[model samples]
Target: MSSTCYLSLDWPTAPAWVNYNSLQQLSYFTTVFLAAPLALLTGLGMSPALSTRFRRISKLVSIQAARSLHFLVLVWFLVFLVVHVALVFTTDLQSNLNQMYAARGGDGWTGLWVFLASMAVVIGGWIAATPFTLRRLRALPHHEQITQHFCIQGWSGVTKWGGVSMRTILDLVKPRPEAKWVVFYSLGDGPDKWRYYDAHPIEQMSHRLTMLAYDMNGRPLSFGHGAPLRLRNEVQLGFKQVKWIEGIEFVADFSRIGGGHGGYNQDHEFFGYHQAL
Candidate 1:
């Protein structure tokens, strides 16, 4: 099949050797056009940063549903791979292997050898990556414990969060007398990364419930649950509770940072600056 066929919804007539019927043609089209795009959309919806910032979209897709769809997408890709490989071997194995592995038309063992070596490199990289990933996660910082009420979406829970109070930390920094907002920054990178910061009224920092937590439920917070640090602001919606916190800054206003909407969510998704709900 030509590369252009992949871009269009038009179904290409199957080669006579493969003998694909209408049902198979429909399946191929759906997998390439519908399934692939759906997978990408669901994957984006599952992002904590995106879901939290874009609450309306999150409500439509839901994080749990996004996660489920992502898994189904994986299954679809696996099934497609199996069918694709079977067809390649059945129709003309040497030609397919040569085109993909050696970028030429040939019936030589060179293409097969190249394919095997590529697989080996992939497997070796995966094997070498595990320990480094573990070490990075283990290096996350730790803090003191404080028990408080935590709320997200429609769920509420009381948990012991280990961290220093925001008030206590602010005292150490000696923020400027005129500063009226506190901004929290998190660890994230790249274009898809959330702007990674939120600004709140300075007075909120002194509330007894405001804290920067490193542990939750009497244990070190896992990476999946925001390891290094997470904010706890009892009065705001959970999105205001920034995770993977890296720095804190006192500012008179947040109109100059990011898109100037007060916080990442506010700028990207147009969420309310002060989300008490």
Candidate 2:
């Protein structure tokens, strides 16, 4: 995916200036050079109390600048990678890869690589614990004291809802003590049905009702697809479901909303949440 992403940027040639014409090169350099160095320096910077050298580097490079650069590079890389993957699916995908593994045809190296990459993705689930993930999840918290009205934007503004706290919602439908996983379902009327599931014991589940904090199927989920969070189920019909979610509850009856018709907004009515068939 990285190789394809770099290719999709269409960098026929490297430019002399920093802000080159190719966004691909910028992504590559930023990831390999700028962002990587900054990450290392950040860890060093954290030890300021112990190492003056670390303190000096952190002070000199301005935390904001380092952080901004890191995020920009990451976003660029992911965007390019997604495009590249789509193109691979479009082009001679098998031939393109077979060319590299021509010598080891049918060997286990390719399979091994796939397995390793999968492991890397699973291990990356740790990103949920980061401070950034927390902020996005906590964007909207459910408050019993306050009249909870969905304030998020959706189709025709009919679906009025915002994020609810993972803890708050989970508390409502307390899971079994042995419950191994929490599932979040987002069923849109369109082709946006999504499901986000997170295993327990790991802090991968964030407090955000919409923001999920985990990778999906050995790859990180991108934005619009509930990025920085793991999408469990298929996209469901409802804008309210688009937001972050941590857990899911299957209630046979939703009499308060509608008897035995407990689903999303679009499921019950022809709301703008779902597309016209």
Candidate 3:
């Protein structure tokens, strides 16, 4: 793919350049002298062993100028190659067509059409190459968000979070029609000997921003934040973001869960079970 990309950069060369006029003194000098030095410059420029010396050289010659010259050499080589290939094809169309088309004896137009079709496929592939390999922000069933968090404790702050969307989890679990809530359990226990836990409605769980976060501000969640994992339901208050989460239980209702409340705070402090904004 890299080779094809390098070659295709010079694909728009005019057909008329295939004639004897292109092999002038300048072209000959470039093919012999410039080609060898350009090759050496590219090698030394990329070499870790030579990097310090190369930097000193770069101060005098400028690495950008060397790179430009190397690229020009590549372009010249590609154009020269194309010209020779075109010359071969055009010099004896019938014979070359026979050789190219598996020695299948036929009219010259048949081989010409075949060549044109191959060129179309090559050009189309070149155009689509970048998009096929390009990736954005290293995401795979992941999202990054910067939002504010406010809790009943009167604490408020903003943070950037990175995690997998709850919607992705829903697609994997495929909850039954009766499962109305998702209960998240934490490894941390409260003073009352109950584990810190919370519940979210099935609809809220499917929200795009509702996620299981393992990253905070481009790094793994710190202990002060939630190490390992935490829940992030954007539409709700910060208390619902269960920290040090251990397990998840899908249920029809939260009545059977701890303290018959939807969350640890709701059970202990009489806070409302649902707080959405």
Candidate 4:
């Protein structure tokens, strides 16, 4: 008599472990193990029973030192995040996502749903980071005055525009019924070079006009790089719109500032204000 048995086995090679540099591996391990455990220990250190032992440890690595180490690790994590993002863009993003999902042995329907969910998280996170969304959430509070320089304004060519939501900014200002004008004052480093456009009435202005917080390439605008806010007015030429705004005010006339020419536009400059398409 003879007996026959069949067996199936999966090996680690089936998953093909990706190689990581020492720093990369250490970063991943610390995030997964040491960091979490340290946090738990920090919390436990507050407990009365563990007070003696905790104090002993604390004396060895004093409280201030521990805090500094924790902060340093946090900064390290941020650096890791940058490297991770670079790798994601460098590699095939879809393939990586697919491989991760495939490891779960999910049915077709489940895999599809997971893919959709993952996409949603990425898109949702991007949207949440946008200036428009962030402003709505009060992440960038409307200040009475800010001295942002005009870093970049959209041009017909070779010009950059920060993605600023003009509609929301107008709403924040809430100009009076009698005040029909929107006056933008350039109060930054280049106040002398300030240009202004005879913008349309807030109500009449189309949504196309907005304060950009990001560039056309989807990159965030930094403070010095003309970020946090930008104005776009269809009624005025692109250059007339200011970037890195310092102050926004509602006034009856642009001439109130000086030289009855309304603004730099009224006084012919190199970039004359014209209605943009």
Top of the candidates by lDDT: 1
Supply candidate 1's per-residue lDDT for 200: 84
The TM-score values for the models, in the order shown, are 0.45, 0.29, 0.48, 0.36
How many residue pairs collide in each prediction? 2, 30, 0, 12
**Candidate 2 regions off by >4 Å?**
1-35, 42-53, 96-277
lDDT tens per residue, model 3, 169-218: 78767899999988887766566544567888889987777888888999
Ranking of all candidate structures by their TM-score, best first: 3, 1, 4, 2
| Candidate 4: tens digits of C-alpha lDDT, residues 1-277 | 0111101222123234366546557768977787767756654433322322243554465434555666766676687688665554345444454556655432234444666798899999997765434455235432221222333353244344444456656665567777666655442323332233233345433354445344534455666654655555544544556655544556555444433444545555434333334
Q: Pick by TM-score: which candidate is best? A: 3
Say what the RMSD of model 2 is: 18.8
lDDT tens per residue, model 1, 1-277: 4435444635443344346556567778989898999998998876645554575776677666787999999998998888777766655677768878998886887777888899999999988764323244234443444444555556656677776677776766689998998887666432444346788888888887787776788787788677777788877777778887655677787676666787777777884556453
Task: Give candidate 3's error at residue 153 in angstroms.
Answer: 4.5
Candidate 3 scores a C-alpha RMSD against the true structure in Å of 18.4
State model 4's lDDT.
Answer: 0.49
TM-score (C-alpha) between model 3 and the true structure: 0.48
